[model samples]
Target chain A: MEATDRNNREGLKAWLNPSRYGAERISYWLQRLTGVGLLGYFIGHVYETSSLTQGPDAWAAMLELTQTPMGHMILLLVIGMSTFHSANGIRLIFTEGGKGLGKPGRPDYPYDAVSLNYRQKSGIWIALILAAAAMLFGASVLFGGE
Target chain B: MSETIEKLERLDKKRKEHEKKEIERSSIYLKIFRANRATGEQAHYDTVEVPVQRSTTVLDALLYAKGYKDHSIGIRYSCRMASCGSCGMKINGIPRLACYTKVSELYGDTITCEPLSNFPHIRDLATDFTQFFEHHKDMQPYIQNENADIKDPSKLSEFVQSPEDVDKFLQFSYCIKCGCCYSACPTVAMDTKFPGPQALAQAYRYFADSRDAATEERLELVDDRHGIFRCHFAGSCSTVCPKGVDPALGIQLLKGHMLGYSSNEKKIADLKERLMRK
Candidate 1:
């Protein structure tokens, strides 16, 4: 009974957390957040690539800066979010483009017409796998896991 | 004095003869939903027994109840025909002109009368129209075409329109602004951003007009989330529209135009979706 009570208390705490509403709100915010994340990453990538214009020394300095523990972690986080956002966007593009996410046969129907189905589920699974792989690769280079 | 007495006797005889021939009518209970906004109290219904004859309209019943039974019942009525656009209310869960709805057609002893939906209630069966009419005013619902300066009929000439071109917008042009469709719209109930069915229908009326210079500009107004996309096409607005203007069709047509699809192609897509879902 005590153990059961402890489990119930933890459940209650989880429900009461501020992030409870945050999770539910994510689906609607997913597109906007992903757009912002991708734009930021693209800008940063362009700046880093521009270093090659200066000399090899500038390029090496930028690379070494990204090799630090905190820098490496930030890069991994950005890549992970970008992959998730991109996959979800692809799922939406199919939906908005009238490819069936809900109804299987009628691929050209509007997003609202077909109820969301396994195609979207597949998109989500694929995104998660790609993000995990990126994270693993990112950690390996930084931590000597390679 | 003798002439007045003789006249009174003749009128009495006529009254007696008319009573003998007069058909006995039934009395009905009108259940009206009343809300007091001053107190910030919610709506509640009160049933009033009204004496109604076969020829009596719903407006007649309301007037009878107000004049004889209770004077506090609030109602706005003028030009009792459907032309005036006043006396609009929800009769039996549908927005209808009280002057036009016959009392004999209503089933059950109790007929529910309430204000039009999607507006703030002022009193029993009366709604605040400031918001409803403001939507139309925002659109600048007048012709802004090149021909606005052409006053002379002979100089201007009629805009050459075939029967088909005229028919597309003819149905939408008959809006009385009675707000029957606006009240009955479920989408309007959910979101205020959605420029309700009436406004969208009006927008399309001008957008389809050949002479209207601001078609593209008007389309931009209704192209956003709060504009045409909010309509789920429940078809209730079309059902309740007194003038037979199908705002549902207008909204669907507007949506098709906004989505970059031909009307016929979108219709086929809708049909295909329906079949696939089943």
Candidate 2:
């Protein structure tokens, strides 16, 4: 089929474009991206810490890289990704635990009722707020330290 | 040629012209996906203009294309209404019952119709729902009662249920098994083994039933790694449901039930005892 052929040509990366779906889909994609980003950063951080076994000079070189502009930008990105991932992770925990879902009602006409109630929506808003707040705090500490 | 033969040909030409004029008056453009199973041909979109009114649905448009324009256009629809659930397809980018969606509601001069996503397409606008039904069956979507009196035909009585008990699974009972929820689900698209939202929600429907005796078993069925946990609460399934069946909410409630955070066990037992007394 043309649809199957189109999917094969595009590969799984087609779903990575959050514009294809709604806000919830965009949030889902962002959560996955941030998770991957944090995992990558965790591995790199662990590897950098293990370089201390190579002696003081190697450790000094790793520390010196953090002083550069590029390293500072990378650290900022790490902070941002971690904050978003952690905040969103909390939201997922609550949803998976079924904390915010309201009582089930009859399926009425217009079919406008949604599963994500006000509580779930507020949880998502809270996650976004917390992530933004953490980013602002991290930026202040990073730039303020001369 | 004979004069009589020439006169008959003239009348035939006039009839054809009148029919053409009538067709032009009510024609609406339908961009439909088509494929042939016997010829080993690849699928492609075919644009057919057919006579339609403002209230013409996608199913009506498809039938017009099939009956007048082209007989090769494949579509599956049992009832013209939304009850049968056989006419489920993707109209534009959203999954919906083609019979329920009016042409006026759809934007653009030419309406686009395709088979439901996350299912094996049999042909144009018709997907194989075998897997969907299989998943639904795997959940054992029915009330289970082990009571001897309930089993005996002579002893069977009405199982009294409160309005509140009915409210638990009432929304979920509206599902027509359309596969629209499965198509709209991103998790089902990513992982085929997730059983999709339709089955999981129906599982919860049965689980929440006060008359059901297999609540523990039903809970265990959907508590697997790829079951309720696969749902990330995307909320797209509920958005596209024509009957307002909120499978997303049902899945979460099932999660809550499995986690021991919510239950109406005592209430159900009391209802059952009352019914038994009668």
What residue runs in model 2 are displaced by over 4 Å at the alpha carbon?
A: A1-17, A143-145, B1-29, B50-53, B148-151, B264-278
User: What's the distance in Å from true for residue A15, model 2?
Assistant: 4.7
Give Cα distance to truth, residue B246, candidate 1, Å: 0.7
| Model 1 chain A poorest ten-residue lDDT run | A103-112
Task: Residues B1-278, candidate 2: write the lDDT tens digits.
Answer: 69769966776776566444432225568888776544556888899887778678889888888998898788899998899999998888678899998776665678888888788767777787877899999999887876526557886657878999899888899889999888878778777678988999899888888888787788788778888788887777877788988888888878876777676574557689899999
The worst-scoring run of ten residues by lDDT in candidate 1 chain B lies at B261-270
Question: lDDT at B269 for candidate 2?
Answer: 77
The lowest-lDDT stretch of 10 consecutive residues in candidate 2 chain A is A5-14
Q: Model 1, range B1-81, lDDT digits (tens) per residue? A: 997799678767765764465444599899988776655557788899998887788999999989998898989889887
lDDT of 2 by residue, A26-127 (tens): 677778888888889889889889889999999999988887777777788887777777877777776766667667876545455555566656766777
TM-score of predicted chain B versus true chain B for each candidate: 0.79, 0.83
Binned by DockQ into CAPRI classes (incorrect, acceptable, medium, high), candidate 1 is incorrect
